[model samples]
Target: MRLAVVASHVIQYQDPFYRRLAAHPDIELTVLFCSAEGAKTYHDVGMGTTLRWDLELLQGYDHRFLRNFGWGEGFFRLVNPGLVPTLVRGNFDAVLFMTGWAWLSAWIGFAACRVARIPIFLYGDSSYVPDEKSVRAKLRAAVMRALFGMTSAFMISGKLNGDYYKHYRADPRRFFPLPWAIDNERFVEGSAFAPGERDAMRERYGIAHDELAVIYSGKLIERKDPMTLLRALARMTHPAIAVFLGDGALRADLERYASHGLPASEPPSFPVSQEAGRPGGSAKSRAAFVGFVNQTDLPKHYAMGDAFVLPSHFDPRATVVNEAMACGLPIVITDRCGPSADIVRHGENGYVFAPGDDAALATHLDALARDAEMRARMAQRSREIIATWSYAEGVDGVAAALKSIAGGEQT
Candidate 1:
């Protein structure tokens, strides 16, 4: 089967899965990237820095970048005039749209595919969270029902996302669970450090052997809520090390909160490193702010930590949670995260607290710190759970959808 994938950009997490799908013997995949903004050096407002992905995104895939008439960043800004003509002439048996909202290119592709009588597949990560009750939201949902009716199949990220599609009147039989997965091999390889190597790496990062190291990665922005983690850590009396990876606009504020009791007007010591035996220093001083670590180097950082925390105010589906799970670290995520239900087995693999609850986050951290055996048990469960949510499983879902479509059974 010849398949065409239309996406706004090549994301770090999705790129690997696309490559895997391209490698299949029965499927010939062509990815249409609307913008090369992420491939080139672009300033990410979330990370608060310019980033060029270290990994090769287009290496092993049959792909092309559509001509982008410059508007600005994000999906709504993307204007590709050539998208419809390209899809109409590409002779693809099926077309998969990464997202249908906020992109003119995606809408055009959908229309062109329908006109050509080609099967339309949708892969989206949208969840049924922050339940909107406004009239605008209801009107949008009604419109979404019409749009989703044009598709042959819906490839969802998780159960929550499946329910979101169902909420828009998508056929349950046509809904396939193409789970949100990461490069598990890359993360597992990164986590497999020698005993002495793990100790040395932790020591270099100011994390002692006895202290529980709690690590938080992703953009240090307010929505990600890294400050909540810091505040929670500050109020804790437990002996643990707080590590913040990545950079953003909230850096100064987080650093101030980490060092002092309040957010103050002072330049933060970039990449602060504190030793174990400092004169008149407490465990709180062990908090380190390590700036952005690239994709290849993130595994070792995960290895150094006893647990991973993502205190996001709202996240559609955080793929970093999958990465941390592959590294065998128990997660502590907010309930607002879409993958929390699928990835986190509340109090089993990790704890899921309500968003913006600093005291609850602190309590979980303290409990994990006090018990070594529980951490080991949860870490084992994490690896086991993440093993099933792999790219291979995603391939199976795509194949099943293709088979169902070929059989003329679009329910």
Candidate 2:
């Protein structure tokens, strides 16, 4: 089958499921991008920037880049005039829509497919259970209900996300709960380095093996609440080392705090102390602040950790938490994180601390650090729970829905 994927970026890490859909053999895929080439990078999805998304990756897929008019965004309306004819001429079997911003493009594609007598399957923003219903969300929900009722089935991350569409009056049977997917091969194969070789690895990076390694892999900005992790670690009066692997506007402030932790003898690599605002009180522990890490090289660092922590103030759905869970790492996340709310069973799979509660975070951190048996129990559960969320399983759910929809075509 020939399929038209409706979204902004054609291929990237931000939309793993869509990318896999493109790579699937049973169907041929075409991408519809709404934004400019280099305007923004969604999540860690490097579309226009990275060559890793070369010809090899999108070999079987066709690409179409949409350009906006006069004021750029405002010109999107102009493209509407030609979008339908263009899609109709492509002779696509179906148009599969994704991304929230692609709402207009999705509408245009939907119209074109109807006139041409082709199927259209919608995905993305349609899947999530918006934390709350806003005036805009209510309108969107109404529109999606209408669109979904007419089109083929779409995908959702889980039961709750799909239930949102039904609440907004969408047909629940047509809303398939297609859980999130990840590259299982990467985690399963792992990096060249092994856990026992951590000592040599630390020495290569000029870090000490004796020092406790606390790792945080995400943006340093407030949304991620990197400060909370810092505060929690700083509050703990003990021997520990903290590593940060991401960058943003907040770099300067975080740098200052790390500098203070760096020994005076070593040329202050990080800031000595925050001039604008102190990290506040004694640093919970020693910190090593490094900028963003490359995805290919990120796993080794994750594997070389004592514990993985993400104290997001409020995250939509933490995918990296899933990555950590798959790697058998003991996690410490905040309740505000959507993934933690759904996956974390509190001391079962992993532990969840109250948002902004440094004392509570520190208590868990200290407890996990001192207790090896508890960490092992949590780690074992992590691996076990993650096995159930593989892309194969998620795709099986999607395939069943697809098969049901496509049945009786020969008749």
Candidate 3:
């Protein structure tokens, strides 16, 4: 079977899934990315991650970009729908759309596949909540209702996400929970961390050998609630340092609030990572704003922490939580994180706090910080849980689904 995957951004991270699909001798895959000149105008983060376009990754498959095609976003769509025939000429047996963020791409791709009578599958973790936009946006959704209704199947991440599609009037029979992501072997290999490497990372980050460290990694955004974490630390008494990973618009505010001990904590025993590196010896910032840790270096970063904590205000699903768990780092995540439900085993593996519950979040933080034995046990359990779910299993599940669709399985 020939499958054409449509996306809007650069898919450098999807190397594993694409490689798996490419390796299938029975399946020929074509990845269609949106043009970068086209991407500059697209403002959706979800759309960018889904499309994985413009920027190319060195891979074995034939991936192409359709820049001339006008998307409703970035560039206003034109009436010239001739691109439909061009995509159809690829003779794809199935069309898998990566997301709905780009209405032009999803809508046009769906239309083109329908013109060719090819089976279509939509893949994403989005819920069907109205954006409260203008009347034209509402009409666009109405058109999507008609088009997506014809989907052969869907690859969603959770029951909540599945219900989102059902609310859109999609066929329940076609709704399937196929979670996004599998550990890239590259990440897994990075997980083969040597004790010396961990020690080196700790030294490089200037974290004391015995400091109760809780690391928060990811883009520093309002949704991530780095400030709330600071507030939570304000309620705690443990002498823990928060290693803030990733950069975003809130850096200046976060850096200013990160004075002395972390939120929910007593007093800090040591200086902040940056302060320690500095001469004045006053970086006592709880939120050490170490921005944008590289993807390849994440394992080393996670290894530097005694535990992981992400107090996102409410992320649909913080994949970093999964990455932390995969790295065997016990986590203190909020209920807002999707992976918390599956990975966290309450007191067994880690603690979960309600979003923005500074007091409650402080309690969990103290539990992990004060009880060293429990922290180690939880970290061990994190790795064990990750072992049960391998990238190979995720790939097999995807391949089986594709094969089932080919075999005329009922929706």
Candidate 4:
């Protein structure tokens, strides 16, 4: 089976999976990138940093970057005139639209595939979370219904995402669970630190062995709610270390909160780079703000910690949760996270607190911090859970979906 994957850009998380798909014996895959803006170093508005991915994203894959005539960043801003012609000329047996709604080029490619009578596979991470009833959402739902009708099958990321496709009237039989996974082997390998190496990492990060390290990776933006994690850790009576591993617009305010206890009036001004080093506060309540850690070095940070936390106010699906789980670290995520249901077994692997609930987050952190045995058990469970969600699983899901569609089995 020959497959063409149309995406907005080469994302660090999805690139590895695409490589695996390309390597499948029964499948020949080619990735079509709408923008190469992220190929080199660029300013990420969300991460609030001018950064370049350390790992090779385009390697080991059959891919090409389309001519982009669009201005600005993000999927909505990308415009590729060559997208439709490329799809029509690729002669692919199937075309997978990775970001149909976000990119105009993707929609054009989808239409090209439809016109060419090629099987269309719709892959997205959207979930069926309830929101305020609005005409825009309703119109979007109607658009999705039409798109679902045109597609041959759906490749869902998780249970919530599958529900979302169903809500848009996608055939349940045609929905395949191609989970949002990461490079599990790489993460596991990076996580295997020698005894002395682990100690060195602890010393370098100022994390004492006696103090439980609760790590939070990803952007320190308002949506991620890094402040809530700080407040929660401050509320804890236990001797724990809170480490924030990414940078964003909230860095200054977070640094202010870390330096002085939650401010009474407004947050004090601090340079963004100030938080890159150790922030301020009491010894027990102090938080380490290690700015952006690259993909290659992220596992070491995860390995040094007892547990991982992502207090996202709203995340489609937190891939960091999968990364932490692969590193044999239990996760403490908010209910708003899409992977919370799939990965967080609740009191088994880790706890799931309500969004924006600092007290509840503090309670869970206290439980994991005080009990080393529970943390170990939960960590083991996390590894067991994440093993099921892997790049190989996604490859198999894609192959099976294609095979079923070829055999005229898609409903």
Per residue, candidate 2 scores C-alpha lDDT tens digits across 72-174 of 4432532444557778898766666665334456566677878887766656633345544688878866765676667566566655466555766666666
Q: After best superposition, candidate 3 residue 216: deviation in angstroms?
A: 1.4
Give each model a TM-score.
Answer: 0.92, 0.77, 0.82, 0.92
Ten contiguous residues with the weakest lDDT in model 4: 263-272
Residue-by-residue lDDT tens digits, candidate 3, 110-156: 77877787788887766436574899878867866876677887766
**At residue 90, what lDDT does model 1 achieve?**
88
lDDT of 4 at 218: 91
Candidate 2, which segments miss by more than 4 Å at Cα? 14-26, 34-56, 60-83, 101-103, 125-141, 144-151, 192-196, 204-211, 260-285, 407-411
**Model 3 misses residue 17 by how many Å?**
1.1
lDDT at residue 279 of model 2 (Cα atoms): 50
- lDDT digits (tens) for residues 1-411 of candidate 4: 888898888788898898888888899888988888567898888888898989977888788998988775555587887988888888788888887577777777777877788888988888854663899877877887898887787888988898888887888888777889988889999999886998777656666566678899999787889889888877787767778888999988887776677322122232223333344432322577888998899998998898898998889779999999999987999988999878788999999989899999989989988889999999999999998888887888888789877854442
Q: Candidate 4 — which residues are off by over 4 angstroms?
A: 73-75, 130-132, 262-285, 407-411
lDDT of 3 at 376: 83
Please tell me which model should have the higher lDDT, number 1 or number 2.
1
Instruction: Give RMSD (Å) of candidate 1 vs. truth.
Output: 3.8
Model 1 misplaced stretches (Cα beyond 4 Å): 129-133, 262-286, 407-411
Local distance difference test, per candidate?
0.81, 0.61, 0.67, 0.81
Flag regions of model 3 displaced more than 4 Å: 36-56, 68-83, 127-145, 260-283, 388-394, 407-411
Q: Give RMSD to native, each candidate.
A: 3.8, 5.6, 4.7, 4.2
TM-score of 2: 0.77
In angstroms, the error of model 3 at 218 is 1.4
